[model samples]
Target: MWFKNLVLYRFSQDTDITAELLEEGLSHQPFRPCGKTELSSYGWISPVPGGDTLVHQSGSFLSLSAKKEERILPASVVKDAVNQKVEHIEAEQGRKVFKKEKDQIKDETTLDLLPRAFTRSNITRAYIDTRGGWLIVDASSFRKAEELTSTLRSSLGSLPVVPPALKQSPAATMTQWLEQHAATLPSSMTLGDECELKDLGEDGGTIRCKHHDVLADEIINHLNTGMQVSKLAIHWNEALSCIVGDDFLIRRVKFTDTLQEQSEALNAEDEASRYDADFTLMAGTLGEFLKELITVMGGEEEKEAAGWETKATVTVEEGVEEDAPF
Candidate 1:
């Protein structure tokens, strides 16, 4: 810390000020940083030749005592203190934003603040107080939170007005209608200006979307189908060829819902899983009716099988015998 205490005696290059001890090394003192000092004692040493010899003036040395413990903060503390230490600045920025005032500061270009105090990382959500102290934000500590509460009201409290058409019509879904007809939904809608989509240049379209392009189609299809939820089976080997839609969402659809007791109708060990779902409607009602008909007819019996017992048909007419030659 010798350098910390070491005084810098620069030649005071200002025209308006001059005093003692400012000339520390030359023995002829000059200007000072703090205050004027008495010219306590003076002595003149004359040069041999000149008309008036130069005077070597001296006095009590003016002291400029440094008040700080160190001239500069250590590098690491500087990095952290500016980051977390300033609370007053944070209070100002957050408070003014709540009121509809023109005076407001954004906490941009800085990292999100952390809990430490006075680490001056460029990343900031902070400001400087009148005393030059940094004020930081503590997200976990609700110290100055009355201000944040009202400002946060604009986050989730309001709902967008779905068009009277979307709300009233039972046929069109929220996703489909929004896709084909956003212009009629509302005009310049806003959550206090936070959520409004950015307008592109004159000829271009709006640059934001409520959801991904692909997601809107998928969700619309799910809502339209008979309102039956697709069942997801966790067991893999128990799976049938019944995966639906595409990729992972697909699964076998069967008509029978109850766990059926094993019988000739469902012979294979793999077919046991078909009993897990209801095959009744799936046969002809809903799930893949055309495909199910093909599977039932694929059996070697080829002809239409008898209906579930007791519906035996009476003979329409006895078959006439063809004569054979001996």
Candidate 2:
């Protein structure tokens, strides 16, 4: 386990103090003139598991499937769940505040008093600990810790100032995150819908969609022989770890989960069918295949967009009924 803590301090004045001149420095406007200083510059993994953790997920998988098939619940229920998620975030982030003070003191022996000291700004301190799991000690005695807090943001780009609503796990690490906190969620998503979005390869940009069940076949027969399905999936997962489903953040999703229904759709060429987990298709040439993938995925438009040439200008929302057409 590793722990990283950051502390930044700001001062009101930059002057040295001596015991004898304490009173004089305090009483005097300018303590002995100090030499001018140069312009100051400011400076700045895991594995599968066993036991209850695994068992609980297995049960959860079945339970969630049953719940999902329970007619999508009422709009009110879905709204309540979303509202609860927001409130939870607000409570965790809450607010950061701090206090500052100064006092006067005189050196009895030297017959001198020290001037009052001032603390201009506040310092923010954060503690991150990872053992069996991970926890963040986000309390700060200083005010205005946003910048310092953001410094902790990884190159991957996930905003971690606030506690992550999604717990960290192997299989569910990311899925858990999207379900609980994704802002612009894809609606009409089925219980088993699974989409893998990615931003990688050539120009460091690429998108591809293949039938979920035919995933093995499609990957094996992709028009481009250079790309590997499993490798693409791994990259997509890594990038999403940092994006964290924010509205301003545009995510490139890759549709990966290939289900039995999805396989059938490609055979029948159903464009709107949904794959098991509602994964979006890669854009362009890949999108056509994505459309077919959707047929079995479920929760797609009846006939897809009339002008649906590619996978742009489209969005899926929460609690929406099955859309897209074959």
Candidate 3:
């Protein structure tokens, strides 16, 4: 119900997204357990446990989950098996095992070990804000978020979604905020205890501060030395706190006790009801917060006109008789 991190993607205006369309598209790739010898399997799943639907709707928000099952096979174990086989073959035949044969042995070893490997499953939850045409993923890194998006893209054929673009860079805006010590910041946002600064030089260095004042003299001295803020921690209207990175990543998100208490006050009788209600509240709150953030950063960057095409060149081999009739 709660997300610890946020990775945002905005859908194009032309994309006709809806709950029914998502449910149908996602049905084509429902969650399946990993098969033997397969490294991983990813597909859509229900966000609520014991729920049958792939898409959970709460007002304009559509919740979705992607489950990934992966087999754990140690590389060292495969390498040791390959090496032992190579040594045995070389000793018995009195000949060196070349790279090609050794590689084959490694592949065989890996396949042989895969059946015995332990399997683990992980679920990544995300929601589409239909009102804003935004896809918000609960992931710590872009790689993890992309895994879910990639699967969703494959399911839907093509997904016209891209990361949020801002008119002003987060680093420069945050640096200016620190320089003015909350004077230039919006009334809804205030400085938190953590920050990360980097030197804008060939041999760049990083300084990360936690549990220290971001506007303290020591930190200001570093800034005076031409260091720029790469990440800054901030509290948003006393409802949420998170670290916003220059790369547009929101990390370490914590919802305030007030928000939680409000959710708890709903007093749902079952897990499904509670999840739905809590998600609705969270999505509504975050929608407003993100809008305020976008405004504070001077609004979103203008996107290019749609339906542009790039010309591609193909080179055929001189010896090949292109699609010759037999």
Best by TM-score: 3
Deviation in angstroms for 20 in model 3?
Answer: 0.9
TM-score of 2: 0.17
Please say which candidate is ahead in TM-score: 1 or 3. 3
Q: Can you rank all candidates by lDDT, best first?
A: 3, 2, 1
Candidate 2 lDDT over 1-326, as tens digits, reads 01112111111122122222322321222112211221111112000111111001111110000000011124464445445545565679794222211111111211121112111222222222211111122122112233323332221123222221212221232333233433322442322122333333555443334335323344334323443221112123211111112111112233344422444455532322322122222112122322332232232322233223221121112211113110
Ranking by TM-score: 3, 2, 1
Clashes of each: 36, 37, 0
Least lDDT summed over 10 consecutive residues: which range in candidate 2? 60-69
lDDT of the structure predicted as candidate 2: 0.24
Clashes of 2: 37
Q: lDDT of each prediction vs. the true structure?
A: 0.22, 0.24, 0.84
Higher-ranked by TM-score: 1 or 2 = 2
lDDT score, candidate 2, position 245: 21
User: For model 3, what is the C-alpha lDDT against the true structure?
Assistant: 0.84
Error at 216, model 1, angstroms? 4.6
- Model 2 regions lying over 4 Å from their true place: 1-130, 133-205, 229-326
Better of 1 and 3 by lDDT: 3
Q: CA shift at 50, candidate 1, in angstroms?
A: 58
